[model samples]
Target: MYFGASASALQRLVEQLKLEAAVERIKVSQAAAELQQYCMQKACKDALLVGEPRSCALF
Candidate 1:
């Protein structure tokens, strides 16, 4: 029936949306991790330049 076909199409759309959402989440997580790494590296470089051994010890 037409109703059954409509329901199937709706289900497919929902699944595609879910997949896209998951991909977005992964991308966001990766970006956040990269940002954290950059921040840590910058902090370490700064500490080293200032000769602050104690500050760099946290890494």
Candidate 2:
């Protein structure tokens, strides 16, 4: 998953899902270029978590 700002953005997303305890791993990134590369490498086709519905298409 990619968060726009800081790790807190990811934290909030986890909190929203109420799956904090279920999450076994977490990776945080603020660099847009790095995030884009990571996502592309992972072949991430969709945003699993996002603050806004419209942002889902970003993945």
- The number of the candidate with the highest lDDT is 1
10 residues in a row with least lDDT, candidate 2: 49-58
Q: Predicted candidate 2: what Cα RMSD to the true structure? A: 16.4
lDDT of 1 by residue, 1-59 (tens): 44657877988988998998887445878999999899887885675556874643457
**lDDT tens digits, residue span 1-59, model 2:** 48466899877977978875676654555466678888877664444532345643458
Residue pairs whose backbone atoms clash in candidate 2: none
Question: In model 2, how large is the Cα lDDT of residue 57?
Answer: 45
lDDT of each: 0.76, 0.66
Candidate whose TM-score is highest: 1
State how far residue 57 of model 2 sits from its true place (Å).
47
Query: Model 1 residue 23 lDDT?
Result: 75
Number of clashes in every candidate structure?
0, 0
Per-prediction TM-score: 0.33, 0.25
